[model samples]
Target: MALDRWIALVFVTFCCAYGYLAFATMDQLLPPFMQRNPVWPSTFPKVLAILGVIVGLVVLFGLEKPDSQSEPSATDINYRRLHEYKLGQALMLLGLMALYALSLRPMGFLLSTTVFLMAGSAILGERRWVIMFAVSAVAAGSVWYLVQQVLGIFLRPLPFFLGG
Candidate 1:
C-alpha cells in the first residue's frame, strides 16, 4: 500500500494548495462594497486550507509504518486488479447517473426518482426486494412532496407512467 499512501499524500497537498489559492484569489477584482458583506468571502476557503494542512501533516507523518519483516509472496493481487476494479465501479456509477438524468425528462419526477434511488441501492450491493422497494418509494415520495406541494413548485409529473 505504499503507492496508496503516496497518492493520499499528493491528494492532500493538492487540496491544501487549492484552498490557499481560493482564499487568496477570490476578491482581487471585487469592488469595496462587495467586500463588506456580513461574511468574509474568504472564510470558508481559509477553513478548508487549515483542515487540508492538518490532514496533510497527519498523513505524511502519523500513519503506522509497515512491518519490514514479512517475506514477499505471490498471493497478493497486482496493480492491474485495482485499476480494473476502479474502472468497473466508475462505469457503473456513470451508467446510473445517465439513467437518472434521462429518466427525469420523459418519466417526469416520481418514477424516475424512484428508479434512481433503487439503482443507487443496487450499486451499493443491496438486494432485498422488500427493503429496496420500501426505501425507494419513501425517498421518492418525500422528495416529490418537498419539491412540489410544500415548495409550491409544480414539478414535472410522472406523465409517462401516470399518463398525461
Candidate 2:
C-alpha cells in the first residue's frame, strides 16, 4: 500500500475511535439545569460523533486506490514530508491538550494553559524565545480573562509564581 493510503487509513481509524468515544460518553453526570434549558445537554456532541463515524467510513473506503507498484515523484514526496510534519505537530498538540485538561483542576487554569500553549508553539518550530513566551502569555491570559470575566467560569488563578 502507498504511504498516503496508510496515512489516510490511520486518520480514518482515529476518526472512528473518536466517534466511538463520543458516542459512548455523551452524558453529563450533573443534574438537569436548575435554572436553564434541559435540551442543550448532550445533543451537539452526539450529532458530531454520528457525523464523524459516517465520514470516517467514507474516507476509509471511498478514495481512489493508488497504483500498487508506483513510487511517488519528488514533489509528491515533498508534499508527503510536509504532511507528516503537520501530522506530528497535531498529535503533539493533542497530547499537550490532554495533559492540560488533566492538570486543570490541580494546577489551575493559568499555569496549565500557559504550559500547553508554550509547549505546543515550541514543538511546532517557533524559534524566537521572546515570541514564544509572549504568545503563550497572551494566549493564556485571553482564555483566563474570557473564562473568568466574560463567561463567569471563575477559573482558578495560577500559583504565587503567576501572582494571581
Candidate 3:
C-alpha cells in the first residue's frame, strides 16, 4: 500500500478506537457539570472520529490517479523525499507528546510542558540552547499562569514529594 493509504488506515483505526473509548467512558471521564451540559462530553470525540473515518475513506478511494503526462518529475521526487523527512519528524513529535501526556500529572503542567516544549524544539532542529530554553520557559510559564491563575482552572497536583 502507498504511504498515504497506510496513513489513512492508521488514522481511521486510531480515531475509531479513541471515539469508542471516549463514548464508552464519558461518564467516568467527564465532570458531573460537563456531563449535564447541553453540548455533551462525548460529542467532540465522536465528531472527530467520524471526520477522521470520512477523510480516511476519501484518501483511500476518492483521489484521481495522475495521468502519464503528470508523472512525478525530479522536483516532485525531491519534494516527496523532503515531505517524508518531515513526516518522520512529525511522528517523533507525536511520540513525545504522548510521553508528555503520560507524565503531566506526576511532573505537573509547568515542568512537563516546559520539557515538552524544549524537547520538541530540539527535535524540530533548533540548535540554540539559550533561545530554546527561554522560549520554552516563557511559553510554559505563561500557559500555567493563565490556566491556573487567570482562568481559575485547576491542574493535576504534582507528586507529593514535589511540594505540590
Query: Best by lDDT, which number?
Result: 3
Candidate 3 is scored at a TM of: 0.62
Write candidate 3's Cα lDDT for 89-122 as tens digits: 8899999999999999888887888889999999
Q: List residue ranges in candidate 1 displaced over 4 A.
A: 63-91, 98-107, 147-164
TM-score of each: 0.62, 0.56, 0.62
lDDT tens per residue, model 1, 12-107: 888878786877787686789888886677778877877877776666673544567364345533564666455765688889998888878788
Clashes per prediction?
Answer: 0, 0, 0
Clashing pairs in 3: none
List of clashing residue pairs for candidate 2: none
Compared with the true structure, the alpha-carbon lDDT of candidate 2 equals 0.70
RMSD from true fold, candidate 1 = 4.9
Ranking by lDDT: 3, 1, 2
Better of 1 and 2 by lDDT: 1
Clashing pairs in 1: none
- Candidate 1, residue 138: Cα displacement in angstroms equals 1.0
User: Per-residue lDDT for 70 in model 3?
Assistant: 53
